[model samples]
Target: MKQTATLKFIRKHSALAPICLIILLFIRPTYLYAEELKLPDIGDSAATALTLTEEKMMGAAVIRNIRHAGKLVDDPLLIEYINNLGNKLVSVSNNKDYRFNFFIIDDMSINAFALPGGYIGIHYGLITASRNESELASVLAHEIAHVTQRHHARAYDLGKSYQVPVLAALIAAIVLGSNGNELGQAALASIAAGSAQMRLDFTRANEKEADRLGIKILNKAGFDAHSMASFFEQMYKESRLYGSQGPEFLRTHPVSQNRMAEAKLRANQMQLKQPPSSEAYYLIKQRIEILNQPDDKALLNHYVLQLKNKTYTVREATLYGYAIALLRNKQLNQARKVIQQLRKQAPSRIAYLITEAQIAAQSQQYAKALYLYKSALDDYPGNTPLTLNYIEALLKQQKYGRAKSILVTHLRQPSPAPKLYKLLALIESKLGNQVATYEALAHYYYHIGQTHQALNQVNLALKTPSLDFYTESRLSARKKELQDELTALAKKPS
Candidate 1:
């Protein structure tokens, strides 16, 4: 009789009770009202039918925190490579424009996450954890699945708006200088925090569904579908070996027994005829490790292995990757020599050109860097990353006028990034145009930072035209926060 009752409870609750028991014992619940609540109407309809303006707005707030909390790894070649793979998968994905932005975060955490409207955050740790491009694709496709499936929106409507609170909490922690991986773990803890087993697995089911969908997407995109299962199997083994000391990614994204089984079963069913070539795998793996490791004998040790294998183009690219890593580590002289060789090998690569310019600028050869940047633009028109680097070089040289000119030109062209406004503010300030500078800064601050001055700036800047969805969202959120702050200040003054 007791067993029957226990089974009934477990059935009704799904598989969330275990997670809840673990989390509730540690932290107080933020959304107790959402614990095991039901809302069939939530997130069931197509995205086309739902009003997403508010969700997109909430996403903007979190994006600023995400961008601020994590450093964007700016290897154009690697980014292009990753994006090419991502775009291939996205082509077959339902959320096509969710125009997914993929960038490496400068962290060692083995994790990946996505924000609404196509923002994907990948860690160097996760990059290294992935054995190949297909495995990396599995991670991205999973996150993209969340956005496509509207999991956050569903979570919001079902649970009464947890996304905003979670984003706010994360941003707050970041502002307080908390470690991003640590804060991210905390955020994930709060996700299924106080829920019952049934409720928690409801979300896990979504995760499982995403995994299945992502595998299918990979299969169609000509990537090895089994890579998903292979990566999961590796992660599972690592988890067991390390026990609780495993990567915190496993903690938030708890690799349940069923998930592992499903991954294996799915991989076997797919029976891919060929894996991604060893060269591609090595490219991703070496790039990941080179980026992850600090400037130590460890990097040199790996370099020795590459040196011994002259026939390996993958190793050669890794050598170039190591050189770039060395430059980032402030080994300027070593970086210059390696880059010079890289340029000799691939003279037409814009990234090598930019790196050379960066090296010259670092050595206070501003004119050299400036000339290289100009030549690069002339050669490769409409290269966004190079354009950003060129402007950065100009700013470093205190060529505020040229920087502003670049910003104005770029802003006028088609489909500019909202972050450009923030850059403009910096350049304007450098130009000693305080009035225009404050106005621009206000736009960036209020929209990106959700500050009062930012609200004021947005109002000033957009007096007579349509604001992009990103800026509009920022303006609204900042205005609200500012109003609340003013109300509290007014009360204190009395």
Candidate 2:
């Protein structure tokens, strides 16, 4: 029955098949005999099994698939917040050489997972569920440890004696299992029923090591070291409350009394300190709450009730969320009033300033909005959210040239948001620069994992009339890169 459910789940999510195939293609058993295989050693032997480049490729491919499935949260504010928080922990981590990319999964499940190559994904639900920043940081630190320890590669190394298909299935199962779906649970169970006990034992060991290291990283990063243990204890208690259906995090990172005790004991040995959570964390949480609401009026009403009853923990964040809800509901005057109140409290708070600017823009006061953005930019120059908003206000006023210039400057920075490319495409289109528009659109599509659309845009650019020699050369080269990527993807076993 479990096997049937597992197969059904795999068939339903057909996009995952290519991910498995990618893993199989990259990870092959060179030594057929188990006796001849040398097990992974303590010191970076996993690197020998799966090179960093291969791990990166695998991680990127999985991320692309996840993006294609629309499971990646695209909110720039939330993205920036999570990355900033993740980097804070990364900065103090022992693995200084590894480049970490942190992202949020749009999932509501309370889980986090680490893909190969330092790609860590936290569920928005986990963020919402966390009582404080340290709880969230602890989760991120644990995932970071998994990546730094090269657990995925080490698992591949350990599984060399097993069939490649089994190993691939196991990898897929683990990813899906973190989602807390019945089919995913079935898949995991089916895989475990096989001769995967040794791998399971290794996973438990990895979990322990990750806990120890995560606590150290958390403490070093100035977070409460006990957060790891506290979070686990909370999850364990919640598991009892939910009976057989605990949090997805527990399904993946099973918390036991013994494990919790060990974490507590380790944390007790550290110099504990209570650090205040950042205001940005609360503001971002409220923003996400507003974004997740399906109905603006309903959300506005909910916030009104919360405020009326004084049920909110953070009044400023509640007000922030209420203001956004009001804006979304097109209560422009009320939204402006609320945001003005917030601005009066903290004249330079970016979230309040942005909200006020948005209110002005929505009221069709584009000049006021532009002035507000410009004033904020003067204070916080090169701020991504501010720059993005300012460029957007410029575009709204049909000041395409100014918007283009600002956007171009922003794009020159490393890893600009994908939305920026899409915005640039709009700016170029407004200016009637067909080649530039197409090129920008191609970049936008590529970043969002729409390779075919990206390739189409590139082709369109190359076919544009009177294209300059230089532009044509660049477009042609990009076109080949896209084609090669597509060809390689197509070549993966079905």
Candidate 3:
């Protein structure tokens, strides 16, 4: 058969035209293939108009893309704990009915932001900068107030020039990388909701409203309302110290002294409430500090001074931080002494058990570490950190089978951790189980938003001739599910 004239026209423009021509020839009547590819209906362009449901769906898509980009904290414990604390503030807010998702961004930029549909991202550095739980809660409440007030939706294309696709792509840029279209950047910075002049103008009222409501939330949520003002005042002063190179949150949120004064006056009128001491917040802060600079000598020295001066609120957590600093610095004996003190402070605390186990691991006492892990897991069944630590000990001891068994058991839980899938892949590879290895990798890829790779892996698993009937059925179902997910995503308008 002779080649068609249209195929020749397409071929002149590209090398891939051959493939394109072949696809065109095979799709029955050729006219259908001529239509340009566009996602499912994005509806009318009503400039900056987005419904709550549409915003939620959009946020869901952006979140997966962000997660896949590796900007999110990988620690399941930190993720869950932060969400829990954020939820505490949400529960008392005017928007108590809203379903919020909280996450920690691994960045140390000292910022926190609320995205569409109750998705909030807090930086690890912001958590570290917090002097108390109230300060942190105040920030979250402010962000929450933004969400509740529909500021993101309000900031939507006021001129109706931008569409959902632009919004989605802009967020992907911020989450995945810094470089992006100037227009998209402006749109997102506005959702930080304070970026450009127009954004600043658009969001000024929203910011004031957020401050007012945020303080109300602080009081209602049992935090000192004054914390909102105090935290802002601190950041404002720090910005002065840096001569404009202060924390990024200050830039995004733009804390004016007048705004801080208003917050202070509002807080003064409300009866002060003594929020219950948050041991968990202090512990997590200590963990964040350790994470940010695991072995920085200057940071260690700062902690040493704090420990010596008895300046920390949660003395036990401060001690924990000091111990971690020692352990990282190779002061093994000092770390051991700190561990003993932790044990004395809280005889049966899970934190103490985990800390001691870590010390044992560092000391090369694998047997002792394994024993402590087992004992703790026995007490705190289904504890992710403890179980992961136990698996680490097993792996260190070269007990692959035991580690595999524990991993498999964890996999049976509802909503298993993605880290479990990644670890299982590693273990399967070590055991030379190619089929199971691919299957585990597939799950890991799927969780991380690599849909096509997951599809490929499941297909490979199905190709293994030794697979049992049940295993084959599972892989086949998984492949189909991934295929459907890709189709749905592709069909959805950006």
Q: Which candidate ranks first by TM-score, i.e. highest?
A: 2
- Pitting candidate 1 against candidate 3, the one with the higher lDDT is 3
Q: Write the per-residue lDDT of candidate 1 for residues 1-494, one digit (tens) a residue.
A: 02233344335444434432322211111112222344233334333222366455545655555544445565655666667667777888887335566666666767666654455667777877776677877777767666676554433232342434354434333322343254334443454343311122134365567777777777777778777767767877888999867764665455656666787677677757455554444555666666567666677656666667664456556766667666666788988998889789777677678778888888888898899889889888767767888888888778888888877887776435446777898887777765566566765564444455665764565453565677657656755766664343222111
- Per-residue lDDT for 46-133 in model 2, tens only? 3446667756665665565556556788877788889889989988888854678888877777877677677788888889989999
Task: Report backbone clashes per prediction.
Answer: 8, 0, 4
lDDT of 3: 0.69
TM-score of each: 0.68, 0.83, 0.71
Worst 10 residues of 2 by lDDT: 25-34
| Alpha carbon RMSD to native, model 1 | 8.9
Model 2 TM-score, all chains together: 0.83
Candidate 1 local lDDT, residue 432: 70
Give the range where candidate 1 is weakest over 10 consecutive residues by summed lDDT.
24-33
**List of clashing residue pairs for candidate 2:** none
